[model samples]
Target: MSTIDVVEVQPPALWEAKRTKQRTVVWQEFGLLGIFTDQKPKIKQDGICSQQLLSTTEKSGVMDSVGVPGPEEYEEQHVHEVYEQIASHFSSTRYKPWPIVESFLQSLVPGAIGLDVGCGNGKYLTVNREVFIVGSDRSTNLVKIASQHQPHAAIVADTLSLPHQAGRFDFAISIAVVHHLSTPERRKEAVQEILRCLNAEGKALLYVWALEQKTSRRGWDEGHEQDVMVPWVMKTGKKNPNEDGSMEKTFQRYYHLYRSGELEADIAAVGGKLIDSGYEKDNWWAIFQR
Candidate 1:
């Protein structure tokens, strides 16, 4: 069995590694289609956000097949990572405020156990007292900052390689971090892992840079520094110092420039059903149902 296997097996590839009698095994493979970003609390009825929300019940972003990371590329990934390490916990992002996070959480309805899946700086998780929340991220340094900031609600883990129980959550929120994944495989793995942790009816919310938005604002466009944005495997998993006086081992992740269709396909392939999705100005946000 693959070390990564956690679900029942019927392996057609990875997750479908078991055999069973078949009869033209069919699936609703309608070409997947599908992110959005906006912080308007108490939105106007039947407005743009409302329209996008309505469309999601039928069709969402974009959907398309994606390639896996090469096996050779896996072992080759090893390097030190320097992550941002200021204790920026409490309600707002480095760019905005706590109420924005609260307002977003409020839209999801009350009492849904939620997660800040790349909950950097522990900002929202720290001060937003109403939601049943848990915090997770790939960076140990950032996790430390989170623990120091909101010790009650944090866990250190990678979305690519999660360390959580299956169906353990009701909802997950990722903000301004999905694009950093760098590759399609990592992207799928991240989504798959997150879904694995959700209850069947659970939700996964993401705040991502909008593909339709002008590329000038994103760091991955041309003239972007490869060494800075795309991480390099330094010494093959060896511990090393980074920019912020912390230590990390670089894992293989490739940043992707998403189109709507590709995002939708990803959610469906992993047994997910998209609920609501849209893009607003600079970022894209979507919520998927497991």
Candidate 2:
């Protein structure tokens, strides 16, 4: 009979001091276990010990086994969550409808069925009251806010997959929407979806954030990531009882800034003919026919 010895090794004094209440214990009989004090675990996988060390870093917010999000997921998270969080504040600021968009809306025939994709607060839906507009948004809260604006119909739907029959709408408008889509494929799909819902001779307007914007203070010549996060500051008028609430909270939103001719290219990619396309007020606007 062979006797095995069990030794309880104490972690280094440096590691012991940094250990928090949250600790992950791995039991192994024989092997050199490398525990890092910098929150990054360097584990050796060979011989008798084949298990991997699973740890999380608080400072970096990176966790093991939890997969990182792709661009699409990050876009969805920011678009959905940020809008939901700031829906009230957003509705308050979006009271005025764009005159250019209103002029386009007026061009539609009276009693025409129109689709307002990604309609936040339904500001544009109120335009051309003669045309019965059906508003749809990805954010449920914003949809609810839009419902208050008295659209003919309000539905929660994704831009990529609109909840409408083919050729059901005489016209469609996707304002400030396509840029939220993370990938080119998704942006194309959204345009295709709008075209699918419109009649064969129908026309649609699409708007996206422009790379050149005076308000953004981003230089046109400066190199920047196409996909970026913009912050929205939330105002809380009253100070907290416990502490001074002078610090305003800000929410970050995902936006895919469009370069010159990008909007037209996206429309052309979806088999739509671009009637007109240009930049206006920090956004790229395009009118297309299906």
Candidate 3:
């Protein structure tokens, strides 16, 4: 991605429902730190940008707070930066929501209000006008992009501490954002925030990146090292091992990969139920009824 993409992000301009002094900042990484790639994620190769957008890099100095930025802020900032970087690799105009999100929306109650948390550019808004949908993302530029794409859709704020009232949306869907969270503690909070926003009996749909059960754990970017408890290697690289292990690994962090059974336990801890869960397109999509 071009450095110009950074120039496009305005930290002060990021979306905020109401600016408050000493606002309680929720620092959930949302899995941004998990991009443990030996290779730098480039826009061109990732197919996130076209040649024209890559020519320039925008510089927006980081100006959130005085002390070291917290993990959530760090991850959030990283995502915005990556978002800009990837923009150079692909046309931001083109979009198509994944089948799971689309299919879930199809079952919505008439006049049901839906929240697309991390709604990237509001492509779903254009497709599902039948339901009242509001798309929101922490990235100010992306929100603006979404506004341009889906003018009718409401785009605003971060999910960590949402501005909306409890039970605001009939259902809330967070796709591909959970994996950005580096730690499970942060992810659970995100889940709570989402659950808090849903009405009783409301559904919260989430998609988490997971490795298949049958796949060998060795191929992961974060290799597995041997476990003292388990016979085989739990981790391979230097420090962090077992991060690349089995489904149990992801739950309690037995593996870097995520498995349905592991996630279900995590979901249960937060008083959320995984009504339906499955693997599709390398993502474990869970439909949770609160």
Candidate 4:
């Protein structure tokens, strides 16, 4: 009774208010007992406390720590956006068709129905008029450009999910396109989609950037990531248009570089019979029969 005075300590107003609000939400959502029963908060590598509201595995499928988009999302956004932004520049540089591609088109039977998946600028579509070719691409801008260049029809459609009927096309070609699929699953899906659109005896051709190209005289480097965004520098002119001397703008395009046998293996995985496969001129080409 003689003389001790009791004192109470309180957290700072702002911090205490935030804590109160959090507690209120927790209680409202899970009830008061849940505050104790829930798992302890986890400190992330970045030194922030995670709510521990959902299991790590539950959220891991959609996003990583710090909320970065997963591979599929990143690939879709990057590939489509970059292609749209640089469609004109890209089309201007893609006027020539590869000789091998031309040969494959020439081999197709006359009046045979064909599909061109990811037919940028429709370079290959212009070849082999005897074969009625329909082109599809993911980029609308590229599709428009393709429509202007080729008399064949062009549609903005994804290779993984073509708008065509199954077993409709006698032949299909996906040149330098499957490599844009940033994951093995996606690459396989695209090949399978192509196969699905083909008749039982239908054949398809695929081209992918070769990993061996790094050793070629062209000096193409296989970057550290198998799936990477390669930059395309568009130079305004040799002379600097700006006083500051910046005449080039770099844009990123997605690519999945393939090793010697990777393209063959991917096609085979989808029950496609490989007719022939080889590495040529910084690319891996394969002919497959459905």
Candidate 1: give its CA RMSD in angstroms. Answer: 17.0
Best by TM-score: 2
Model 2, position 71: C-alpha lDDT score: 46
Model 2: residues >4 Å from true position, as ranges? 1-66, 214-222, 239-244
Q: Tell how far residue 77 is off in model 1, in angstroms.
A: 7.9
TM-score of each: 0.55, 0.74, 0.60, 0.73
Query: How far does residue 101 in candidate 3 sit from its true spot (Å)?
Result: 1.4
> Scored by Cα lDDT, where does model 2 land?
0.69
Candidate 1 worst ten-residue window by lDDT: 25-34
Model 2, 71-105: lDDT tens digits are 45666677788898888899999977776798899
Question: On a 0 to 1 TM-score scale, where does candidate 1 land against the true structure?
Answer: 0.55
Clashes of 3: 35
Of candidates 3 and 1, the better by TM-score: 3
**What digit string (tens of lDDT, one per residue) describes model 1 on residues 1-290?**
11111111111111111312211111110110111212222222222111111222222211112332232232123111434322222222353433434566666655667777887767666555556777877666676666665334778766666667888787777776666664456667778888888988788876665444333322233332221222222322235465544343232232334555566777777778888776655556677878
Tens-place lDDT per residue, model 3, 212-261, is: 52242222212211110001111233553444332211111111246546
lDDT of 1 at 33: 11
Per-candidate clash tally? 37, 0, 35, 0
Where model 1 places Cα greater than 4 Å from the true spot, the runs are 1-80, 84-102, 108-111, 148-152, 215-254
Which is superior by lDDT, 2 or 3? 2
> Cα deviation of 88 in candidate 1 (Å)?
7.6
The candidate, 2 or 3, that scores higher on TM-score is: 2
- In candidate 4, position 92 carries an lDDT of 92
lDDT tens string, model 4, 71-161?
5566666678878878888999998888888899999888899999999888898888788888989889999988864458899998887
